[model samples]
Target: MKQVNALTVAAAVAGALSLAAVTAATPAMAKSVKCYGIAKAGQNDCGNKAGTHSCSGQSKVDYDGGDWKGVASAAACAEMGGQTKPFKGMNPKKKSS
Candidate 1:
């Protein structure tokens, strides 16, 4: 009986540790894009139209960490025509294609 009790406790602890490890090991979702000065898809186009020109405005970015835990913020995306920004700006279009 004593051995069985000890084994059961050990198993429970192991199971809990496995669950914690899995949760902690989960990866966050990250996205990357190419942002040209005036032509791109989904990103804000200075003229208000997207999908054909690079973005040149401001937008909000939302990053989800797979488990629904996420973060969001507003950012400014601007550049000269025919130039690509260091990092692609956020897309503000209702739909991204």
Candidate 2:
């Protein structure tokens, strides 16, 4: 009985130490910014910038200026020729006409 108790306590301590080490070694969440006009068809990360939808995969066209994705860096939006703010996004149907 004594040996069992000692083993249980040792196991508990080891588990707790392992959890603490993992927590300490973990990195923080990467910061992301909203980048518009870059998402492909139905690839928007979240809601539409135009308030047209409240769910993911709601975009109807590719490279929608009104839709955005969470980019890791702010410069990525402009580098991709996209806007960080809402713009007059091109509508595929209307643009084709």
Candidate 3:
């Protein structure tokens, strides 16, 4: 009975530790900001503001202002030449192909 109790406790501890590690490593749970006009062609994270597409990775133009991606933060997105809101045309820094 003592051995069984010890094993059960050990398993419970291991399971808890595993859950903690997974939670810590999950980037999807981290803070993020919506960044526009930075995603490459077919690389947007989700739907476009123009209502052209309803899914991820569907943009037909590189650096299109109507599309967006999930970035680490607003400052980070601005640093990467991205806008917080959707706009018309592509990013001036990039030429459309």
Residue 20 lDDT, candidate 1, scale 0-100: 88
Q: Rate the local accuracy (lDDT) of all candidates.
A: 0.35, 0.75, 0.90
RMSD of each: 13.6, 8.1, 6.2
* Top model number, lDDT: 3
lDDT of 2 at 70: 78
Residue 31 CA displacement from its true place in model 2, Å: 1.8
TM-scores, all candidates, are 0.29, 0.59, 0.67
lDDT of 3 by residue, 50-77 (tens): 9999898999999999999888889989
lDDT score, candidate 2: 0.75
Cα RMSD for predicted model 3: 6.2
- Per-residue lDDT for 71 in model 3? 85
Q: Write the per-residue lDDT of candidate 2 for residues 1-97, one digit (tens) a residue.
A: 9999999999999999999987874442236778887887788877886788877798887877788887767787677767778677663322321
